[model samples]
Target: MAALAWLLIPLFAAIGAGLWGSWANRNRKTAGDGIELAGYTRFREAMEKPDAVVEPEPHSGG
Candidate 1:
């Protein structure tokens, strides 16, 4: 009985892992690009714009 219980531990663990994996991989976005990809593309476009510029402020020493 003790040996059986020990063996069952791995069986349960495997079952739980399989269930979690399936749940995680369940499909959703079959259409256009995903949100992260779209956001990254927009960010890239904004960064590439010439009008967008950054100016640094001068620091004063005490």
Candidate 2:
């Protein structure tokens, strides 16, 4: 019983720490917001452009 309690104490503490960190970081602003917004506008414009050819990259033989 004592051994099981010792194992579970650290496990529960780790879980609690992870949950706290995630909650703290939930409201932060990310760096790519402006880039994403610009990309969205460009995508909308591309939809209206007739000559846009979406090309798939040739896969390099990994």
Candidate 3:
């Protein structure tokens, strides 16, 4: 019974630590803020600039 209790103490501690870490990071924001708006702005700018070639297909056939 003593050996079983010793083993379970560390197992429970590890489970508690994992739960705490996940809860701590729940509200964090990533680096891609305003990404959609920025992409649209760049696309519009590329269309307006005459020197830039807005190719119909940017990717070549593999």
Best candidate (score: TM-score): 1
Question: lDDT of each structure?
Answer: 0.91, 0.92, 0.89
Q: What are the TM-scores, per candidate, against the unseen true structure?
A: 0.46, 0.43, 0.43
Model 3 lDDT per residue over 1-62, tens place: 99999999999999999999999979877777599889999999988887865658676678
Cand. 3 Cα-lDDT: 0.89
- Best model per lDDT: 2
Tell me which residue pairs clash in candidate 2: none
- Put down candidate 2 lDDT per residue, 1-62, tens digits, no spaces: 99999999999999999999999889866696799999999999988889867898999989
- TM-score, model 2 to reference: 0.43
True-structure RMSD for candidate 1? 5.9
RMSD of each: 5.9, 10.8, 8.7
